[model samples]
Target: MKITNVEFVISAVRPDQYPVDALPEFALAGRSNVGKSSLINRMINRKGLARTSAQPGKTQQLNYYRVNDQVYLVDFPGYGYAKVSKVQRQQFGQMIETFLNDREPLRMVLLIIDIRHEPSKDDILMYDWLKHYEIPVCVVTTKADKIPRSKWDKHVKMIKTSLGFHPADRHVLFSSETGLGRDELWALINTTIEEAKAEAAEAHEAEEAEETAEVSLEK
Candidate 1:
């Protein structure tokens, strides 16, 4: 994908506020301060399109970033922030759950996790939840630059083991600082988009054929 137009679409808290264009959407999920913003910035080749904050729990809604008008990167509010109010956390949970469960255009979730440490309980739970719902997910272990290159495999293994990582889902080791995994991630996203389009076309053709058969029977 060439580096081209990018737009900050909207910060949506409810389904009604979501974009109506029906572009394929990829949700970014992780704990607060887990480098979701930085990953987005690196992926888009933008210095600061997605705002990064030192403060935890700063993002409270679904932030939509339209890339080349081909897809939307939906940024979910970071979970497991202790400082955030319990009620607020519940609200965030409900918001995310509703979107994930009902959103038709959502393609896959890029679940970000810091590669320097073991996957947290929250991380494990989130992964499990996504799997339970049969939602497509790509676990993105971010901040790979912080870890030494020689021990990358060791850390990745630990994270995978701790999460009981599913074989079918993707696990990408990413470094926002070094641009590691950027091309690979983009390739995965593009492939998914194309697959979705193909599936939709097939479904449309099937429906048209069924309609034609019904019309012939009536005639």
Candidate 2:
């Protein structure tokens, strides 16, 4: 997607603060330092749209971005920051859960993880939670340029297996610095939007049909 316009909509600590416009949203989820902010900047063709840091857990709220006046791209706070205090960690968990479970405009989630290490326990749980909700997900293995080309397949397999990801849900080896997997992700987002549109249409038709039946029975 060519982002013609980009703007910060809000930092939503509460769900009510989310953008009221009915635009499809693609969210990025991951552990701290998983390169999500960098990925968003790369996607939007902006230098610092999402912000970066050597410090982990900088994003504590749902960051919203309006793209090309068509759709919303959300940068969710990464979950597994080691240095976070217990109280802060718990608060982060609540925020994440509220956005995932209650937010209806979310179309798909891109779960980011480091390519060099095994998927952490928090990563596994995040994946499982999305699964339980039947949410469509695309796993992104970041910092792929750090590894040799020969070792790419091996690391991808390790991540999939560690997270118990099925063949149906594949992982993309992403490099924000190199723009790896950018086209593939765009295609995925397009497909998700089409699917969501079809579902919404079907639901609207179903509701109309029920109303018609009620009217005829009352006559």
Backbone atom clashes (below 3 Å) for every candidate:
0, 0
Q: Which digits, one per residue and each the tens of the lDDT, describe model 1 over residues 37-128?
A: 99999999999999999999999999999999899998999998999999999999999999999999999999999999888889999999
- Ten-residue stretch with the least lDDT total in model 1: 1-10
Error of 1 at 93 (Å): 0.2
- lDDT tens readout by residue for model 2, 1-219: 777899988998987899998899989999988888899888889998788988988998888988888788888887877788889899888988888888889988899999999999999999999999998889999999999989999999889989999678856778998999987887788888898899999999999999999999999
Best by lDDT: 1
Per-residue lDDT, model 2, residue 132, is: 92
Question: For candidate 1, what is the lDDT?
Answer: 0.95
Q: How close is candidate 2 to the true structure, as a TM-score?
A: 0.95
TM-score of each: 0.98, 0.95
Each prediction's whole-model lDDT (CA): 0.95, 0.88
Query: Model 1: runs farther than 4 Å from truth?
Result: none
Cα lDDT, model 1, residue 87: 97
